[model samples]
Target: MPPHPRTTSPPRARRRLRRALACAVTISGVLLTTAGTGHADPYAAPFPAPSMTPSTLDARYATERRSIEQALRTAHGVGDTGRARTLGAFLRPGRRFLDFDPRGRGQAVEVIGDLASARRVALLVPGADTTLGSFDQRPGKPWSTPGGGARAVYTEASRITPRPGLAVVAWLGYAAPKTLSSDVLTDERAGQGAVALHRFVSGVHRVNPAARIGLLCHSYGSVVCGRAAGSATGGAAWRRVTDIALFGSPGTTAWSASALGAARVWAGRGGTDWMEDVPHVRIFGLGLGPDPVSGRFGARVFDAGPGGHSDYLAPGSPSLRNLTDIALGRPESVTRA
Candidate 1:
């Protein structure tokens, strides 16, 4: 034969393959995302009690670090390659994991600086897509990794002028909804997260009862903080919180900041934060409620500049600077929105 016909896949077959690949990718994203939305059954297993508050890190560090190492080994053995790398990095020398449980997806508390002597503590509650496996930050990634934003905040906290013995806590304590999934649209996960956050905050207070505690919640985390704020009245732990600053918040379910029950509530959004486009209404408890940054919501607004949704903690940005100022109790220097 002078020539042979070339073999090629049929167009329909090619289309089918592409669709299959897209679906697989979507499912992978959902599965691998640390910030999951599914409601966790409280009865699944007996969860361990967190460390007693005010316990010196010396008493807790050795044991917790061992837990992290054991969890890392389990991840590697189970072929959870993503989680393996994440847990491994966390086991690096000198890095202390305040609390760690590798069971299921995982839960942890990573401190940026010394917590024992710090007079000011910033507890960062992250939004969706935060899990131990996905917590590792790689350059060129956005909000997908916890290290990006949490590390940024940690670094900025240390840079505060006249450094105020501040320690930043990157708490991946609750299960967050998968980003872009239906879970992000509801408050179920937030409700659960709120309970855990409340407990964590209470324990934190017991550790350094005099520390000036501030909550810096981002995205759906604002919903968690909002829920915790509701029942925090008449409690000393809740009263210890000085400022509740929300950025890129979806909603807080409250009509006004005063309803959050914090001493001072502040809200800010990057000029281009897409969260502003999310609807601000409650529907059968399926929605995020109201936008905290809206004029009618009545939160003290701060300057977040014209950054995007993920840029709130970008170093040198006005949002980061303002947050540092607020954390240091220098509200007078914060630029107004």
Candidate 2:
């Protein structure tokens, strides 16, 4: 018998195939159990649309505040204390929201600092499981919610030298997937989020034409930013985006930073983030693709320090400082990993 031709299965290919199958099984099982049970929010209602005019921002905020107050009254009338409590927080003095909606899972775009006069703006896109009720759950704990996280970054950036007036937007403009669900594994939600995010950024530019914008994307929010970066929908507004920072990201769907169409891309992952174990492979739109921090992805790697998935924005952390630096367009100050 003729000698059998030598055969080998590449390890990298095998690993990817195994991960693909695992993803398939996970998606199938989750779909079977979760079909038609998306848990729609019962308190959904439309509110006033935002005013993008820089001169009218305060008026728009005032309009939204009044709408929120009405929503709070409605929530109280409906006996939904949880929703009422969340809406009540928005009524507090000095809480400036660019956009507010009481609809499903809710949407809020809160500004921390003066947006009207800011020379630099950081838009903080949060990850999964963020909602109105959980907006400020842990209050001063910073990392506990998107709003608190943005505040922490603002606090850190305020301390930067040659203080360039910076504004931070806690943008919960899309419905994030539940952290425990299979939805987080794919970019479906991200695709929808990109459109909303793109519009929001465009509006921001319209309001402040001179300001430089930076995206501070966290976890699944990085996926949203990646999609927005590569999206062909926006105009010169995208050109105003100076930097994009992906932290604790599973993947950006793009193969590399250059592919994201971003001017500059920075990536980091905390030393102890559990997301490190997630497979970085894309198969038939099932996975999130290459890890952003990997050399292969070609992003500027930064030191995220020894923290968990949610600790990237923790007060006084290196990751927070690096994020502030990136937002302020001071890449020279960012600590490399």
Candidate 3:
């Protein structure tokens, strides 16, 4: 009777039974098959994963900047040679210098609009690292490339109001900072640049005294504007500069618009920008005043959406549209979208 206890299943048999149970359970449940398996669901699709690569963003900007620069260059070359030549005259090396010193020749650009009536004029001051090369083209290029953010402003002005004569000028006479370091950012160079800008504005007003002039400053350019506004130079007395528009600005809070004598001041910032998070402290007594976009500053604020730092001139952006409206003096056109 005790020997009968040995009548249990063999190890191989037990293993086989376990394997069979596993197979049955697997077949009864939801099945997943590899790509090569014919049992796989044909309709199941993979999701598009979000990109987390910095290189991808850099490549995107590089491609876009290239395309825009090419288009601008083509447009600049095709226009009436007489006007282009005249504008090119100002864009030359000697004319674009900082000195109003008899030796200092100032640079200028005129974008012609409707001829029937007097028009609004916009003087665009570019930010740091902007050269005649970077003014319209990408950095490190020798030849002037067109269709820069400056040109976009001109185009916007032209399209915004076909009635008022619109003359958009890209004034690159000042030497902008070549980098973003605090040393360069806080140098006396900003004040020097401001002096140059004042002269450029004066020269433009001299040419078209009756035009309603608007000053559009971007980034470090805003610093220049603030400085110029605070200067006591006769050149700052120009009556044509009616409105000052600061976009993607970091400073404006430090100086009062009334002190600068700008009739109207407008400030805008694109949402989701890191600049807003940047400490507003002035370093080495060189950094600019306060944040103009802060409601405490009392500037007419417009929403620039989520384009961040460089979104001001991005095509089809709300910031661009708002800029067009502001340049054209179409206050009603600025919607809060």
Candidate 4:
């Protein structure tokens, strides 16, 4: 008796499977080439701890300014003209930073408005490849940097009718993955980033106890926020963060919003975002988990329009307006997708 067609394994089918596996392996190898190459910043210098009182905030900012000025000089002395140029911008008056360490890829925390008097505050956590050099000039993405994006959101918030006392923090407080490396495939960096983010939130609360905090996480930054919100150590700091918005996310490494421990969670993705094609599953400590924009995730999905991954905060875009609404604590005004 001949074997049943269903039970037979054809040579063509076997070859196809082998080809697919080979292609996946090659792609993985290409991405992992830059893994484990990250090094600590040798020029790092500690600044003052965050202040509790509004009166002392100016002093904190001054200390950071001095640190940046010194870093700029060092960069110039070393002939690192690119880094020197980026650092020089922050030395200008009216530019306020809570933290600035020009070491390794560098880290900074910038405030767009008066945080001390803010009734509503939004902290933006950026994604991978975010370094001091790319802070304002991220190749193809113009307004997607921590500083630029935060400023754009701040500008949008200012245009809101009956505007609230809103402030935006461009938080580049962690060593984000600098390339499409194996580091981004795991949660190691996210875990470290979560700790840093938690500490920053606590500091923000100390500065403005009355402020209601919201988190605006983009791309890989969403994973960092997710880990912080769902951490076992999440306590008073987590409580102060009333809302979280995840945009252009790969995944939250979580199944649903309840796991995030946030009161109100909102999610959105651009209509043309390439992240939609990323494999949404977690296994062997690899791959970001379920999609937050999916119905099963149980988050309020907003209309992001037909922008690409980096166009979410483009001036006058629907995503930017909706993000502004979220930052201003006006959920009623956010248009649903």
**Cα misplacement distance, residue 237 of candidate 2 (Å):** 1.1
lDDT of 4: 0.82
* Residue pairs in clash, model 2: none
lDDT of 4 by residue, 1-337 (tens): 0111221244877646644653364247446655345654446585665564677798898888888888887887778899988888877778899988887778899998999989988999999889888777766556789999998898888778546689899999999984346776777889999999988898888888888999999989999999988883655656878889999887888889899885689999987675665667789888779999999999999999788788899997999999889888889999999
TM-score of each: 0.82, 0.87, 0.61, 0.88
Whole-model lDDT, candidate 2?
0.83
State the weakest 10-residue window (summed lDDT) of model 3.
97-106
- TM-score of candidate 1 to 2 decimals: 0.82
Q: Residue 165's C-alpha lDDT in candidate 2?
A: 91
**Position 70, candidate 3: lDDT:** 39
lDDT value for candidate 1? Answer: 0.73
Indicate the residue-level lDDT of 226 in model 3: 72
Q: Which stretches of candidate 1 lie over 4 Å from their true place?
A: 1-50, 141-145
**Model 1 worst lDDT run, 10 consecutive residues:** 1-10
Q: Which ranking of candidates, highest lDDT first?
A: 2, 4, 1, 3
> Each candidate's root-mean-square deviation in Å?
10.2, 7.6, 24.4, 7.7
Clash count, one per candidate: 6, 0, 8, 1
State, as a TM-score between 0 and 1, how close model 4 is to the true structure.
Answer: 0.88
Q: What is the lDDT of every predicted structure here?
A: 0.73, 0.83, 0.55, 0.82
Model 2 per-residue lDDT tens digits across residues 6-74: 224437766566557545554664565445647555554656565588777878888778778877877
